[model samples]
Target: MEMLTVLLVVIPLISAPITAIIANRYVAWLITLVTCLALAGLSGVVLHHVISGEVIHYELGGWKPPWGIEYVIDSLNALVAVIVAFIALITVIYGSKSAEKEIHDSQIHLFYAAFQLVILGLLGMALTGDIFNLFVFLEISSLSSYALIAMGQKRQALVASFNYLMAGTLGATFFLLGIGFLYAASGTLNMADIALRFDQFSSMTLVITALLFILIGLALKAAVFPLHSWLPEAYTQAPTMVTVFLASTSTKVAIYVLIRTLYQVFPNTYWEEMLLPGFLLLSGCLGMLYGSYKAIRQVSIKRLLAYSSVAQLGYMVVGVGLNNEAGLIAAIVHMFNHAITKAALFMAAGLVLMRLHTTNLEKLRGAGKTMPWTTGAFALAGLSLIGVPGTAGFISKWYLVQAALEKGNYVVAGTILIASIMAIMYVWKIIETLYFEGPDKLTVHKVGSGKEIVPDLPVATFCCYVMVATCFYFGLYTDIPLEAANTAVEVLFSTGGGQ
Candidate 1:
């Protein structure tokens, strides 16, 4: 089991340099696909173990706890790791074909190497028990992500990557400084050990200062509202596969860090003053409104989805601010739902980009008629984005509403309703452009064979359908995500992580 945990991070890191040295796109794709699948399988085994009420802990160099690097697998992190790995599996499979359109041929293998590095970083961040070790993985993910974004064929992608690099560096610095403060206060860096020491400094000024620093830093990484200036352009200009994987996993891993820092390293009473939750609730609501409004104005399909990501992230954070078991469960559920949902949407966007060579809303007019499979996949993903019944998105919103109502926060409940309505409007725009509008809205052209030659696109279309299928399956079945989320929530609120 411990070996499985180690392999989760190792396989991707090991594959990266090998892919780089080979510089063969097909070979890199195969290596990425196989590694992602293996990771998914390993994550499944870890989830099984954690679900059975046992934690998996691995120590490095025969040292223990605060003395050495450690990886801890509990219900919470194991589930998150599973989400990241599984999404990587789906994205890599789809990217194998989609990359042929968006990425430069010379950079293809390099892109795959960076992609693997990203998976490695995310899994490491999720599994590490040491605060400093998490920071190391955070840097790994952030740096590789910059390279991946820079690989975008568009000139603007370099600017976007630079912006991301600047913002990421600021966030990492804040986090590292906070860790220093925490080490000074607790004399240890292990998460569990730090939690055990919170009581000793409950009244200390430095402890609260560290908490604020860490929270702000992670909120930046998660792209929470005002700190999210770097997100839209970054998501819009990056290559399709880069945007897909980052949207589905990177911010999510950052959120995991925030949750772990709060629930594992801080005492319950630390946040009972209503300051953190109240501010989070405010920022979350603003983010939802802001992201939705921007999304509605986007002409580019990818940019629209990028803003929608901001709003969806707001929903998850809103659950956190609710600060209860149901709230935690809603947050976890939404994280998983949004992962698959957004990935599917991006995959669909990639398919359209592959076929039409663009994602402009106007240019996509009548696309549904010619690309039924891709358009249908987009509609399904759109429905999930809107939180319609029988979709994964609905389940998370339902739990969030219930959690809000439980807290006697009717304003939040109302805000959620408004957000859903706003989401519907954006989704309606996509559908209307794809089907209801006329094809003459944009010029049509043919390249090469004049026979409509985009064979690789069909592979991504199939992958998008697979994503849409899971969105419904998880929505209707409801057992897997619910049980895992419930267990995760129980662990955070109960004595599972320790009082």
Candidate 2:
């Protein structure tokens, strides 16, 4: 079991270089597919073990306690690990064909290598018990993500990557500085140890400084409004596959870190005095409104979805800000729900782009008739995004509204409803384009062979079906994610067990 813990990180990291070395694209994709499947299986096993009231703790180099590096797998981290790995698995399957369409043949192997590395970093961040190790893994993922985003079509991709690099670096530096302060105050880097030692520093000003720095850094990384300038470009210009992975998992991992630092490492008494929940609530409300307003005016479909991400993240933060058990569970459930829904939507966008060679809404007239299954899948996912009942998105929104009502905050509940309406408007724009707009009548031209040649899209109706099935499956059942989220919240807020 202990060995299994390390394998989560080891398998992906080791497979990356081997995938890069393989010259044949088919072989490289095969390698990536196998590795992702293995990871998904391993993550499921770990989740099962953790949910059975077993926490897996593995110390590096046989060293234990506050000294050596450790990997901690409790119900909270294990559930998130499963989410991240599952997203990776689905994205890789979607990517196998999509990569051939968008990326050049020569770059295929490199793409897979970087893709696996990003997943490894996310898994590492989730499992590590040490704050410094978390920062290290965060950087590894951020840097690789920059490269992946830079590999897009527009010259603006370079500019987008550069901007993200600057922002991500500053965010990372702030996190490192915060870790430095914590180390200075407590002389320990392990999270559990820091929680244990935090009370000893009754008058520690550095802890407060550390708290602010870490919060700001994580907020920036998570693209929580006002610091979200870099996200639109990065998501719009990056390769579709990269956008899918980042949308589904990367920022969610950052939010997980925020949850860990605020609720797990710091004492609850500290937040009570600081009114942290109020501050979070304020920012979250602003982000939700601001992002939805911006999304309504976007001409590019991908850009619109990117803005929606900012709003969706706001929903998750609102749950955290409520500072109640129901609120926390709502936040966790939405995190998982948004990940799958966004990944499915983005995958569908990639398929459309492959056929049309563009993501501009104006150019996508009557795509529904031509690509019925793929467009239908997008519409379903879009409906989920709007929180229509009987979908995964509805489940999260239902809980969020319930939490707001529980707190007797009618204004917050109203805000959630209004924001969701805004989401419906933007989602409907794409749907309208696909179904109502008539296809342009253009002269057909044939090149190369006598066979009528159309753009070879990597994603087929089959890939779209897989994602749509997943959306409905989790949407209807609701037991697994809700249970896991409830357990995680209980573990996080239990007295004498950190915050």
Candidate 3:
């Protein structure tokens, strides 16, 4: 089990350099696919152990906690790691055909290399027990992500990457400073150790200062609104597959870090005293409104979804801010729900880009006639995004509404419904364009055989269909995600904070 835990990070970390050195795009793609497959399998095993109530803790270099690097896999992180791995696998499969259209052939190998590194970084962040190590993994992911976004087809990609770099660096710096203050107060870098010693050496000043720094830093990374200036353009311009992977996993992983720090590292007394829950609730409500409003304004499909991500993130954060079992469960379950829902939406958009060569709402008119599979997948996923009953998105929102009302926070409950209505507006824009309007003749294209393609992009559309199915399957099944979330919530409350 320990070997499996270490291998999860090692496989991708090792494969990345090999892919880079090969300099063959196909080989790199193959290596990336294999690596993701292995990771997905390993993550499943880890999750199984976690579900069995075994916490897998491995001390790196034969040194004990507080003295050496450590990897910890509990119910919370195991679920997150599984999400990242499987999503990466799906993206890689879809990218096999989609990336060729968007990325230059010469640079594709390097893109795969960076993609592997991203997997390594996210998994490391999920599994690492040391705060400093989490930062290291965070940088590994951030730096590679910048490169990936910069590889977009448009020149604006460079500007977007630069903006993200600036924001990401500032976030990392804040996170590091928080770690320093935490080390000074607790004299240990291991998360569990910090929690154990928290009350012993923690001063009010150091605790508040550390919490603020960490929270702000991670909020930036998570693209929690007000600090999310880098997100829109970045998501809009990145290569389709890269955007898919990132939209599904990156910000969610950052939020996972915040969850770990609050629930596993800091004592219950610390957060309550800091009034963290109220602060999260207020900020989350604002983000929900702001992001949904902006999403309704977007004409570009990718950009519209990007803003929707901001609003969806607000829903998850609101769940956390409620600071109860239902809230935490909602947050965890939504992390999975939103990841797949957004991945499907983006995958569908990629199909549109492949066929029509644009995601412009006006240009995509009547795409449903030419590409019914893609349009249908998009509609299903969009329904989930709108939190319609009998979809994965509805389940998360249901729990969120229950949690908020349980806390006597009627405003939060109302805000959630309002956000759902706003989601319907933006999602309807794409649907109307795809189905209700006439196609622009200028956007049509033909293959070398002079046959115009219909029901375009089978492979990528299949991937999109897979995602769409999960959105509905999980909605109805409910047992897997609910069980994992319930276990995670139980563990978190057991460790510290109580309702």
- Candidate topping lDDT: 3
- Per-residue lDDT tens digits for candidate 3, residues 1-499, read 8889999999998999999999898899999999999999999989988875578889999999889999999888999999999999999999887788778999999999999999999999999999999999999999999999999889999999999999999999999999998888878899888887777876658867887899989999999978999999999999999999999999999989888888888865678777888989888899999999999999999999999999999998898888889998999999999999999999999888877678888767777877777889999999999999999999999999999999999999999999999999999988998899974343554332111643356788889999999999999999878888898888888777521
Candidate 3 local lDDT, residue 458: 75
Global CA lDDT computed for model 3: 0.90
Question: What is the TM-score of candidate 3?
Answer: 0.97
What stretches of model 2 exceed 4 Å from their correct place? 440-459, 496-499
Please give, for residues 1-499, the per-residue lDDT of candidate 2 as tens digits: 9889899999999999998998779988899889999999999998888874567899988988689999998777787888889888888887776677667898888888888889999999999999999998898889889988887767988899999999998899888999999899999999988887778973689988998899889998999877888899899888878898899999898888887777789866687578988888888888899999999999888899999999999998899888888888888888889998999899888887766567787767776766677788899999889998888999999999999999998888999999999999999999998888966431122223211344555455566667777778888999777877877778777753373
Deviation of model 3 at 328, angstroms: 0.6
Off by over 4 Å in 1: 440-442, 445-456, 496-498
Off by over 4 Å in 3: 439-442, 445-455
> What's the CA RMSD for each of the models?
1.8, 2.3, 1.9
Determine the C-alpha RMSD for candidate 2 after optimal superposition of all C-alphas: 2.3
Task: Note the residue pairs that clash in candidate 2.
Answer: none
Clashes of 2: 0
User: Clashes in model 1: which pairs?
Assistant: none
- Please, what is the TM-score per model? 0.97, 0.95, 0.97
